[model samples]
Structures are given as structure tokens and as C-alpha cells.
Target chain A: MNIKPLGDRVVIKKIEVEEKTKGGIVLPNSAKEQPQMAEVLAVGPAIANDEKRKDEIKVGDKVIFSKYAGTEVKLDGEEYTILKLNDILAVVE
Target chain B: MNIKPLGDRVVIKKIEVEEKTKGGIVLPNSAKEQPQMAEVLAVGPAIANDEKRKDEIKVGDKVIFSKYAGTEVKLDGEEYTILKLNDILAVVE
Candidate 1:
């Protein structure tokens, strides 16, 4: 990824939900809502420079974000979401 | 107003659109879009503490904000909007 986010924005890759059930039945894409969970791919310079937020969110962190938040973009045939730091609700440990 | 905004939020009172036209035709509320201009009532601590923004926005300053931004609130029979500082697009001189 050659793209870098500006301000306090973050780049995240959505973590796809499991399609197969315990019974081995595969669910269709339409059966599920878009997952809000994502892996942080990059953090913007503002967040990086902020002493408080720099330690809170980092690249490779698994996070849960607001469902309706972020702008979706396709880069190199891969989809990612760019959103402000405030949109990320929690970091999943 | 007794309301105090948190974080980088601000409280603003919307400037009502003129109902009467030059030809003496009175336009109904439904005929016009809500005005995006407002008067800054108060600014949050974070914005006030920031050296750059403190000089940029001040109480009683007229400002233009994003159309869909801010949370509407009714207080003491008057209406107001509470929004983040980022939602304020420009200060009207």
C-alpha cells in the first residue's frame, strides 16, 4: 500500500466474517451484514504525533469501529476503509 | 444556555432564514432548506486550550458549518446545535 492517510485518519482492512457454520453449511454474502471488525493497516501522522492516541492505536491492532463510519476504497484490488480516529470504538485484544 | 459541550464540541445557535422576499412573498419553512450558518455560543475545553483554534473561533462569532453536522437540541424554548469543532467550516467576518 502506497497510500498514506492524513490528519487523524486510519486505514483499516475489514476482517471478513466466517461464512461456514458449525454444521458445515456455507452462508451467502447477503445473509450477513458487513463486519465492523478490522485490522489497522496504518495510522495517520496526527495520531502518530499525539502522545495519548499513539499508544492507543497502532498498525496491526484488531479494532471494532462504528458500523456506519469510514469511506471505503479499493486499492490494488483490495478493499480498505479510511476513517477518523474517533470512529474506532474499541481495540480488540 | 446551561449546556456545556465536551471534548472538541461547540454549541451554536442556527441563524433562521428570512421568510419574506423582496417582492413581499412569504416563504414557508418547507420551501427553504435549513440555514447552515450559526453563532458560536460556546467552545469546548480542547478547542479553547489549543493555541491555533482559540484565535480562530470565539464566542459570539458567526460561523458556517457542514450541512449534516451537529446534534440538534432544544433548550429553554430555543433550539441549538452541538457539534465538533471540525464541523465548523468557516468563521464569518
Candidate 2:
């Protein structure tokens, strides 16, 4: 990807929601809700340094973000959401 | 009026969507899209300190947030959304 987020923005790759349960009942696409979680791919320089900002999030973190948040953009044929640092709700443990 | 969000969370009071334009064509409540913006009221302790977190938001700042981002709750008969710092998209200039 040729995009680098500026300031405290980040690039997130969506994580797919489950299509089935433990009982093995398959679910249609409409039956599933989009996952509100994503993996952090690239983080901006403003948040990468502890001196500039309290860096709680990092690349490769499995994070939960707000639904309907961030602007979606296509990069190299893959979809990504560009979000400010505050758009991420939590860092999943 | 009596809510305080925890961690990186914040309390947002919704800014109602414009029901009419200057041309005076009034819009019904159903016709208006929910405004994706709000005013910052109460901020969490974790986000108040610069050493703890870089505070980009403050009380009374007009902010734009994701419409479906935060958890909604009723406080004192008014609706408010409690959101993490990341859920806030930007502070309006």
C-alpha cells in the first residue's frame, strides 16, 4: 500500500464476522452483522511516539472500533478504513 | 447531566439536525438524518492528562463523531452517548 496516514490517523483492515455457530447452522450474509473489529495495519507518526501522544495502540493490535466510523477507501484492490486515533474504541486483549 | 464516562470515554450531548433550511422548507423529524455531531460535555479522567493521553478534545468543543459509534444511554431524561476518545472524529474549528 502506498498510503501513510497523517497525524493520529490509522489504517484498519476489517475482520470478517462469523457465518456459523458451534451447532453448525450456516448463516446467510444478510443474517450476519459486520464485525466492529479490525487489525491495525499502519499508524501515523504522531501516535507512534510516546512523547507526542500516549501510545496505547500499535500495529498488529486487534482493536475494536465504532461501527459506522471512519471513511472507507480502496487501496491496491483491498478495502481499508482511514480513522483518527479516537475512532478506535478499545484494544482487544 | 449526571453521567461520567470512564477510561478514554466521554459524554456527548447530541446536536439535533437542522429541521429547516434558510429557504423555510421545514422538515419533519423523520425526514432528517441523525446528525453525526455533538458537543463534548464530560471527559474521562484517563483522557484529561497530557502525560496519560494527548487531549485533543475538551468540554464545550463542537465535535463530529460517528453516528452509530458510541453506546447510548438516558440521563436525566436526555439521551447521551458515551464514547471512547477514538470515536470522536474531529473537533470543529
Candidate 3:
């Protein structure tokens, strides 16, 4: 990919949710809000401070981030978001 | 003021825009957008990783943050926002 995030920023590809949950329950459109999970595509280089960029998150890691955390951008006709590392709430283990 | 953010989150009190500018020009209502400046009221405790919480930001620091970076909340009829430290772009100094 041509995109490279800089300074604590991360590029994320949103994960598509299936129509049915893992238990085989079909979700109605209203109940299926945008998924808060995404796969990390790229992470920025280290930032100015020692605190913000320990680089714990890596590419290919599936993470859950805050619902309203990123800026939407289009890449190669695919939608992605650019978020700061701190916006990532949890790493899905 | 009573709200305390958790896990790299920060509480911010937005700075209001005055009708008059510093150069003595009165800005019309349309000219004034929401100010992205705020005072840091509180910061959350550190997160799981050493990466996310070097804690460069501190309470009472004046900062500039992303325009859409936080969740608006009402506290005792006062407005505030809870943001991650990464949402804070720069210190006003």
C-alpha cells in the first residue's frame, strides 16, 4: 500500500460484520451498527515523546478501537481509517 | 469537572470563542466555528502497555485537539469532552 501513517497514527481497515452472529442469530439492519473492530494495516513511526510510541500495536493485529475515533479515508477504492495509537481500546487476543 | 477519564482518556473543557477578535474585529456568527482549543481537566490512568501512556499531557495544560476527537458530555450543566491523549495534537504553551 502507498499509505504510510506518521507519528503515532495508524491506518486501519474496517472488518466487515457478517449478517449472523457466531451463534447463528441473524441481526436486523438496525441492530447491525458499524463494527468497531479493525485490522491494523500500518503504524506510524515513533513520535516526539517516549510515551506515545512504544509500538506495541503491529500490522495484522486485530484491534478494537473507540467507536468514534478515526478519520475516514479511501485507499485503492477501499475504505480505511487513520487513528492514533491511543484510539485503539483493546487488542483482541 | 467531576468527570475523570480512564485508561489514556482525558477530560477537556473547551475554550469559548468571543465575538470580538484579538485585532478588534467582530466576527459574525457564521465566521465562528467551534474552537479546537481546550484546557485539560484530567487525564486517565495509564493503559495496559508502556506504549500508550508516557503521559506527556497534564491537567491544566492548554492544548489543541482534533476537531472531532472526543465524546461530548454534560457534567452538572457544564459541557466537557473525554478524549484520548493522542487526540491532543499540540500544547498551546
Pick by lDDT: which candidate is best?
1
On the 0 to 100 scale, the lDDT of residue B24 in model 1 is 90
* Decreasing lDDT order of the candidates: 1, 2, 3
- Of 2 and 3, which scores higher on lDDT? 2
Error of 3 at B72 (Å): 0.7
Candidate 3 structure, TM-score to reference: 0.46
Model 2, A1-93: lDDT tens per residue?
A: 345554488888999876786789988766778779899988865687647555688889999998978777543467777798888999998
lDDT of 1 by residue, A2-73 (tens): 779999999999988776877999888778777866899999999889864577678998876667699999
Mind giving the per-residue lDDT tens digits that candidate 3 earns over A1-93? 456554477778888877888999999756898789999877765543445455567789899999978776543467777788889998897
Regions more than 4 Å wrong, model 3: A1-45, A48-93, B21-31, B47-52
Candidate 3 has a DockQ of 0.03
For each candidate, give the interface RMSD after superposing the true interface residues on Cα: 10.4, 7.9, 9.2
Better of 1 and 3 by lDDT: 1
lDDT to native, each model: 0.80, 0.76, 0.74
Best candidate (score: TM-score): 2
Q: Tell me how much of the true interface, by contacts, candidate 1 captures.
A: 0.00
Tens-digit per-residue lDDT, B1-92, candidate 2 = 37777888889988876667678999876778777658888999887764534446678977667668988898678888899887765555
